[model samples]
Structure formats: structure tokens, C-alpha cells
Target: SQQGEEDPQALSIQEGENATMNCSYKTSINNLQWYRQNSGRGLVHLILIRSNEREKHSGRLRVTLDTSKKSSSLLITASRAADTASYFCATDFKETSGSRLTFGEGTQLTVNP
Candidate 1:
């Protein structure tokens, strides 16, 4: 359980709003990465932060890490309908089980116009 398991399996937002999701894991990690996936578009890397880092932001997205509690959070600001997609958190450890990422059930986000 070194990977992340997100809560709130789904979320809906109106255009120009914001969305937030939380993730919790069970073991130490080297780094964590967030990814987004749209209907037709493939999974895109949104951001990544190492275990030593506390917070990271990119564009309208912000991520925070709390290693002591083994948890993380992702926030999207000014969300647009076009932002409708699924967001996933992944972890990379110094010792991986063959470089494979364990994914959770995922949180589906939809931004309505």
C-alpha cells in the first residue's frame, strides 16, 4: 500500500469554479505524481513532488504533501468544463515493484458549463 488511494470517487463543478481531492497512502515513497485524463486525450502528467517537498503548484493546480501523516491533496482553481476528466495520484518509491505504479479507484471530475 505504498500507493495512493483517493477519496470522493467523483466530483462535479460548474465552469469557473474549483475542485479539490485528497489522497492517502500507507508507506514511504520517493516521489508522488499527479495525472489527468480526458475522454479522448491520454493521461497527462500534471505535477510531481518528492517526499522531501511539502508543496507544489503548476498553473491553476496546487498540491500539498504531509509525510508525517502519509497523505496529500490536490486543488484546481478556476475550473472550466474543459477540465472535466479524471485525476489520479501515483507514487514512486526508491524500491519499486518493477517500476509499476499502483493506482486507486480514481476520482472523476466534471466541470459543467
Candidate 2:
């Protein structure tokens, strides 16, 4: 099963500051991915960290995964008002049918100007 949940369901931050979100999962996973969704918009893939990797980064985003703990964390540096959105962590695992992806409840981020 690919079940996960994010902490601090909601977060408030100011422009130019850094925002961090944590996610924890229940079962083993093949890889984990982070996504960003603007209000009424489709999800944007941020980064993907494989089970063998510990951390990865792209632009202003950094993702770290801990397979032993079944957890992950995402950090956004120099946040902007435009960065305000809902961030979700999705876990990917292999099943009999095929690979499955399950997303967490998500963390609502509000970046102030």
C-alpha cells in the first residue's frame, strides 16, 4: 500500500523565506514524488527521489527521502506570493497489477507578499 500523510496541514510564510513540509508513509515504496497545484490548476511535478537516493534538488525546491523511516521532506527556498499552492507527496510502489501512486492529504501553503 502507498499510504502517506503530510504534517502541518497548513503553513503560512512570507516572501523570500523558506518553507518546509514533511510527509510520512505507511508502507514501503519504490520512489516518492512531490507536486505543486495552484488553485484550480493541474498538478506540477516538482521532483522525484528514488528509494536508493537520499536527496534531490531542482531550482528553488529540495527533496529528501528516508526509506528506512518511510518519510520525506520538501523545502522551498526564497518563496514568493506566486508560490502559494497546495503541495502533495505521492508514493509510488509496485503491485501485482503494476505500479501504483498514492497521494497524501497535502499541505496548503500561503506565501504572503
TM-scores of all candidate predictions against the true structure: 0.90, 0.96
lDDT values, one for every candidate: 0.86, 0.93
Candidate 2 lDDT by residue in tens digits, 40-104? 99999889999999999999999999988899999999999999999999999678999978999
For model 1, how does the per-residue alpha-carbon lDDT over 1-113 read when each residue is reduced to its tens digit?
56689877999889898899988888788778888988777889899989999999999999999999988899999998888999998877555345556665578999999
Q: Candidate 1: where are CA atoms >4 Å away?
A: 96-98
How accurate locally is residue 95 in candidate 2, as Cα lDDT from 0 to 100? 88
> lDDT score, residue 101, model 2?
84
- Global CA lDDT computed for model 2: 0.93
